[model samples]
Target: MEKNNNEKLESMDTFKKLITALDAKLDSIDSRLKQQQGRKGIVKYYRNEDLKRAFGLSSNTIVKYRLTGVLPFTKLGDIFLYEASKIDKILRDNEC
Candidate 1:
């Protein structure tokens, strides 16, 4: 009876150790995912609708700005993407 109890206790200790190691691995993965998301936030991409809402401008005005080279942008097929960094620079340079 004493030997059986000792064996049970040893198995429980091994199970607890396994749980602790898995918990540490999960925490490390979560931290890496958050770091990657933070890096993406530093260089965000904006679409046409976002620009219209941000600047309170019409579609034609947005096109005019792009066509006149007032703001730099890139178009992939029908979707136009603007860099947040360049937009910030233009706004800062033209600040009143």
Candidate 2:
């Protein structure tokens, strides 16, 4: 009976360790999911020069569009930045 009790105790200890290891793996997976979700929401902006290159337009044309409100833009201090996705849509719409 004593030997049987010892065997049961050892089995319980092994089961508890396996459960702890699985919990740690789950936590790691959760953290990676959160990081991926965070990256999905991030917004990156491009400068006017980069936009001109991206849209295959001249610098002056880019300026005209900005001044005429043909393109949407954001000013961060002295730098102008455009949403890349919006620019892509505009280019697709205009076929240029």
lDDT of each: 0.91, 0.87
Candidate 2 C-alpha lDDT tens digits along 36-57: 8789677778898887676688
For each candidate, give its TM-score against the true structure. Answer: 0.63, 0.54
Please provide the root mean square deviation of candidate 1 (C-alpha atoms, Å). Answer: 4.2
Q: What lDDT does model 2 reach?
A: 0.87
TM value for model 2: 0.54
Best by TM-score: 1
Off by over 4 Å in 2: 1-34
Model 1 stretches astray by more than 4 angstroms: 1-26, 37-42
Best model per lDDT: 1
